[model samples]
Target: MAANRIRVAKDKAELVKSLVASKDTTGPFQTYVEVMVFAAALGVKNKKRVPLGETTKREPSPIPQENFASLGYDLIIKLLGINETKDINILSSREEQDEDKRTQIFEEYANAGLEILQNELRGSVDYSERILLFLSLERDGYPSEKQEFDLRSFL
Candidate 1:
């Protein structure tokens, strides 16, 4: 069995946009983008910092949890390069698991997400909507073309 966790699902753009919307900041998208970039670097540095990148200049707020998750998933998928391989292993890094297992996990997660979107998150407010957006990574568990791109406008 695969591990189940609340992860992101939708396209990167949609998720980012949703996060921006949830944020109390009214500055601009660039601020959030910078913050997110620094946050990813912080994750790599293996330590926490109030400002992710100070040399860059203005010190923005710390990256939020969802931002980390988004960056992490992107790193995982890219590092794993599941696209080049026929499939992936949920435990590939640990025990050399196969792609089929990973693919199955992704499919199940995507399906579950679709169910949730239809039933629970179809018309939620901005805050609840952001939570649902982050949970979309699970819908995006495995790397592949987005199955929800066309729905972007609606989101």
Candidate 2:
């Protein structure tokens, strides 16, 4: 028997386009926009698939990894409303070898990503409308099983 499927928004592109066109450049929304743009730019570096239980070796991204870092930094600036010069100086001065600082930065970015997903649910008429964004990503085979589970739990 076929597994039951959940319904999603009818026009995912249109919804995203409307969101991008909106004037609300609030921290959370801006972060959301940045993430959407970033995700669009991301591409799998390899075409081969591994067996279910095996891990594929990490490959260099199609775009330079530094591009993602720059995008992340831009999101941080928008999300925090920080002055670009001061923030860049502060970020550049950080010890790249410091584990704690690295962890903190990762956490901050994770939080911003989560905020974007959460924001979709908040203003939607129904869960399906917002969840379509995620479903579309999943349909494209973006999320791993664990990530999909976590996202479902969040929903």
Best candidate according to TM-score: 1
Give each prediction's root-mean-square deviation over alpha carbons: 16.2, 17.4
Off by over 4 Å in 2: 1-33, 36-65, 69-89, 97-103, 112-116, 119-155
lDDT tens readout by residue for model 2, 42-92: 211111111112211221111222443555643442322233123433344
What TM-score against the true fold does each predicted structure earn?
0.25, 0.24
- Residue 90 error for model 2, in Å? 3.8
TM-score of 1: 0.25
Error of 1 at 83 (Å): 22
List lDDT for all candidates, in order: 0.36, 0.34
Residue-level lDDT tens digits of model 1 in 39-153: 2332333222222111111222322334435555534322333533444444464553443343333333333333333343335555354444644764666456766557667
Query: CA lDDT of 71 in candidate 1?
Result: 53
